[model samples]
Target chain A: MHSKKVRIITVFAAFTCLLWIFGLGWTVKDYLIGAAHSAYSPPAADESAAQTNELKIIALGDSLTRGTGDIEGKGYVGYVTDQLKKEGLDVSLINLGIKGLTSERLAEQIKEKEIKRQIGQGDIILMTIGGNDLFLGGQTLTNITDDSISKLEEAYLSHLKAILADIRAVNTEATIYLLGLYDPFNEFPEGALTSKTVRGWNSKTMELLAEDSKAVFVPTYDLFQLNVNDYLFTDHFHPNEVGYRLMADRVAALITSGGGPR
Target chain B: MINLVQNEMTKLLGKRRFIIISVIILVLLSMFTYAQARQAETIKERLGTVDWRTELQQKIVDWQNRLSSAGQWREQLQIQIEQSQYYLDHDINPSEPGAPTFIRGFVENSAELFLPLLIMIIAVDLVSSERSMGTIKLLLTRPVSRFHILLSKYIALILSVSLVIFIFGLLSYIISAFMFGNQGWAAPVLTGFKVEGGELNISEVRLVSQWQYIIQQFGLAWFISLVVGTLSFMLSILMRSSAAGMGTMLACLIAGAILSNMVSSWTSAKYLFMVNLGLMNYVSGTAPPIEGMTLGFSLAVLAAWMLGSLVVSFAVFMRKDIY
Candidate 1:
């Protein structure tokens, strides 16, 4: 009986090792073949979609650009694309937004070759910056002095000018829409100060956009100005689906009203 | 004492159970390798025509942009970009798909869970099966002391644990190296990733050669297996049946893995023996299942449990009469 069990054990061990050898050999062979080939290439534009007047929308800037705080994971970018589709326009969006992105980082990002290339390829560019600068990178909203907001506004304007210049350098045709900030702490004690700071920043952004014909400052303060809680996500920073949908509607309206090439 | 250990070793080697368990682990590991390689193939297909250098640069920019924005997962993304930037600056491509570095990554990933379970299968039956087969009387009647006999069995258990781990590392290296080519051992890898107060503590991070990383990883894996093997060994001695020992040990291990994720905020969960088993997470610089679990704290907990089990195991075996 001991001998029989030993024989069974030996066979089982040998069989398993054989399976190991075979499986590993096959996988490694596949890996080798794969490593020799080109890993990825840009997708070719579909002729049918192009015939339907496909619009390439490049969304850039902060977490609002990346669509965080929404359980659906579809930030304003998704809603904008969906609304465009509803209007019988074929749309392809390239979102290059990062979380915690400041105006300075977005300025630097526009200089990257791939991002430059992506921006050049777009018919429209959507941006949400300066939120981090004023909010202090989502740290706190209660501590606000007019002096700090002015300093931030100065830095943000220079960065925004540089960003627009860089985008124009790459592609002069894409319409740039910089979204204005909403007062998330509308119910807080210093909410009034925050509202004043945001409006000051938006007016400055609008003044900068006036210099460029294709650049327009899209306002979002009115949408959440009254019912801030309903529009704001649970984080009290980013917009919920309802908020994103409102922004998307404004963007779609801009596009329909000569925001881009017809 | 040496002869008794030799006898124990032979008894272990001669059994079909040990071989069967080893084979099962081998099969599972190979399947994992196969799936990993398949995934690499699709990634390779997706990366068509883009130079890896350009891709790496693009990834760095993406990480930078992510870090600069106010959003969730900032710390984790920052660490990844830093690691990638290190590789970029050094001109070492650690992201080579299907490479040995990639395969070695899976070892550390699986070591915390799969490796320990494999070692448990060999250990849970060591003493209980002997008692169940009525062979304890025959062994105890010999001139050797009961302590020597149990000690020999324990040594044999350790030897088997070493063998299984050796096979796991060896087979993975041989098969992956053969396919991916024998490269990347000298490549530098970033280590010492740590978190504190729900934020990444960057001060602890460092860079080490891939070879050193592999050695430290295996050492940590072996240490974890020792704790697991010894715990199951104690259980095998206490329980009268091998099935009961194996079942209880398995349940405890699974529960510990699950509870580590769910009740990590529960301060007392840190004291559980299985909670301390993921010591590799600390060495690898990933977030621990629970916050504030340092390497020293886990090691001390494991050592105390090991010593306690050893004392209990010996006390019971020496006093209890053979059936």
Candidate 2:
């Protein structure tokens, strides 16, 4: 019986050994010979096939949209989703927010095939950009001047216009919520100057969004203007959890009050 | 020679090591399948949709968000982001939903460390145990030459190595198929992605069926296991205590795993057998532990190690003084 069992096992092992050797040889041949398999070409984008009943929220922009400063890591976007869920709405969210993303980068990012497809499927598109472009990581404060600020504004406006156009190209029905920047430096020594610059920036943005009927300019300046220090995070630039809550409450209110695509 | 090998096979089967190895694989596969299922569930719950493209996009964005704080890993993350973007652009799901996909991933991950350790469990004591048990006297007294006896044992070791891999593949397939379902065998998988100078080079990228990719992956994995088995075989001949042999092989494997992560600056370390054991990485297009380690280069290095160990094992076993 032992001999019979060993014989069977040996044959099985021998067969597997040969199999692996063939697999090994085939690998070498395939990798080295450079087989000319045709390159994969993706199918054309079918925009209408992805329709669903769930409220798909696609969040795009910088660290603010990414919940960078909020201790719970739920930025305004998270809170907005939470509130909507509380209202008994089925929601799915895709946050494509990269930290320190400028308007230019966001413009380029939205042009990706997957991002475009995601935007086409979204019911609500939330964005927070121009922070890095305007603040330049707090570098603009050192060289605060009308010429520099306007130069930054000119570049930003063009990029923002391009971004809005690109987004509209793929998704015309999704209501875009462009959150206006809050002046984090409102409590600084140059508080008055920074606040004036930020207000100017926000007004310019609002003017651009005015052209799009579905686009809503959510004002966050007033929210942070009063309790600037209390709302600011440790970096004194981004908003804390409570500050994010304040912003979320405003957006959630707009979204619930017929701001969303019904 | 055939009878000698059959004799070794009887002894090997008598040890029931294959049964132990299969049990180990079964236990590990169950844990992995459960973990994978849970992960898919969490992703579904969070996304509220089962669209793979959206999930992949979210992963890319999450990686991008970490780029700022990922001081040392920025370049690696960048490459990964670009590779993922390439997959998204080509509309090829990097991981399709099925047992084959699970097997592909499992094989790639285990090829480097886990599979090799399993090979060692069978090989580490193949000859050392004979010495420890004083069976060398009876075995050597046979009319067969010392070279034939050793060669038969080596052949048996090779056969067992192949069998262990087969068992591993079979058990993982059965368990994961039950968990993930049997599908995606014909799914298109993108391969031949090349990383150079911290950039993803897609010029050589092409599509192969998932089954073909898995076969090629298993081939490379088999080569890796064989190489590891040969080294352990050499140690078995060189050492008297199986425990010491196992310990030495285990330490080397763990060191290889660690060194592959941080040995980018140590270029000379690329020649080491442990470092070259990640043969699957070259096929899957992950950046090598050291720069300039190509598929051909790794294959050559591994083959050289295997041949060198074979030469050492045969020479030592044939002429070494027996107590």
Candidate 3:
């Protein structure tokens, strides 16, 4: 029995040895020559047929959209989804918000194939952009000149226009809630100037979104206008949980009351 | 020669090492499969859909978010993001959901350290155990020359390494298939993503079927395991105590794992056998642990080491005085 077992094992081992040698030889040949293996033509996009009965919410843009300052890590997007779920609405969210993103970057990001596909599948879209473009990570705070502010706003408005056009090209039906910028520096000594700049920035953005009938400019200026310090995180740039909750409450109220395809 | 190898095989079978190795593989594979299932569950719960494209997109975004804070890993993460975006553009699921995909990932991850350690379990004591039990004397006393005896033992070790790899593949397939199902053998896999100067160069990128990719991966894995086994065989010949041989090999392997993570600045360390063991990285298009390391370079280094160890093993075993 021992001899027979050894014979069986030896034969099995020898067979595997041959198999591995073949595999090894194939690897060497493939790596060295890399002969034109038939190029694979990808299958056509299947129109994303798996649309379930849930409200698909796609959140896009910068750190604010990413919930950078919220201790709970749920930015306004998360709060919006949670509130919708609380009201017996089924919602699925894909937050594609990266920190420090600018309007120009968002214009580039929405052109990506997968991002376009995702936007095409959403029922609602929430976005926060232009913060990095306008603030320049607080650099513009010290150099608050009219020339620099208009220069930033001019480039930003063009990028925002292109971004909205790209989103509408793929997904015309989704209600786009473009959250306007608020003055995070409302408590600073130059609070009046910064608030004026922020308000101008918001109006220009609101004007651009007004071209698209389905787009709504959700004002966040008033939310931070009164108690800027209370809503600001320690870094004094992004919103805390309470601030995000306030933002969520406004968007969630709009989403719940708006009449659209379920 | 065949009879000598058969004799060695019989001794190996009697030792019941294969049973132990199988048990170890089974336990590890079960844990991996469970963890994989839990991850899939979480992704589904988070996304509310099983669509792989959405998941891939989310992963890319997450990696991008991490790039700002990734410090030294920024370049690697950037390359990975580009590769992932390439897959997303081509509409090819990089990791198709099935047993074959599981095996491909498992083999790639284990080829560097885990599989080699398994090979060590058999190899570190191959000759040392015989010396410890005083069977070497009886073996040398045979009509067979010492060269033939050692050659037979080395051949047996090769056979055993091949068998262990086969068992690993088979067991992982069965276990993961039970959980993920046995599909996706024909899924398209993108390869040949070359990274030069921290930039992803896609000039030679091509798509191969998933089965071909898995086979090539296992091929590289087998070569890595064989190199590790050869070194252990040398240690088994050089050391008097099997425990000492095992301890030395374990330290070298763990050191290699840690070194590969931090050795980019120490470029010369790439010549070491431990650092070159991640041959799968070249095939998977991951940046090598050090610059200038390629498939050809790693293969040559490993082959040279295996040859050097074989020569040393034979020279020591041939002339050593037996007690």
C-alpha lDDT (0 to 100) for residue A67 of candidate 2: 97
Q: Per-residue CA lDDT of candidate 2, range A63-161, in tens?
A: 999998899998999999999999998899999899999999998998999999889888999999999999999999877999999999999999999
Interface RMSD of 3: 1.1
Candidate 3 docking band = high
Tens digits of per-residue lDDT for model 1, B24-90: 7568767776786786565444332224544575467567655656364565676667656555554
Question: Is candidate 2 or 3 superior in DockQ?
Answer: 3
> Candidate 2: misplaced stretches above 4 Å?
A43-51
Query: Tens digit of lDDT per residue, candidate 3, span B181-271?
Result: 9999998888888878888989888888899988888888999999999999999999999999999999999999999999999999988
Clash pairs detected, candidate 3: none
Candidate 1: tens digits of C-alpha lDDT, residues A70-168? 668778877888788788876766677888888998898788655676676678999999888888854546557777767888998999999999999
Lowest-lDDT window of 10 residues in candidate 3 chain A? Answer: A44-53
How far residue B317's Cα lies from its native spot in candidate 3, in Å, is: 0.4
- List model 3 lDDT by residue over A70-158, tens digit each: 99998999999899999998889999999999999999999998899999999999999999999998899998999999999999999
The alpha-carbon lDDT assigned to residue A165 of candidate 1 equals 91
Flag the better candidate by lDDT, 1 or 2.
Answer: 2
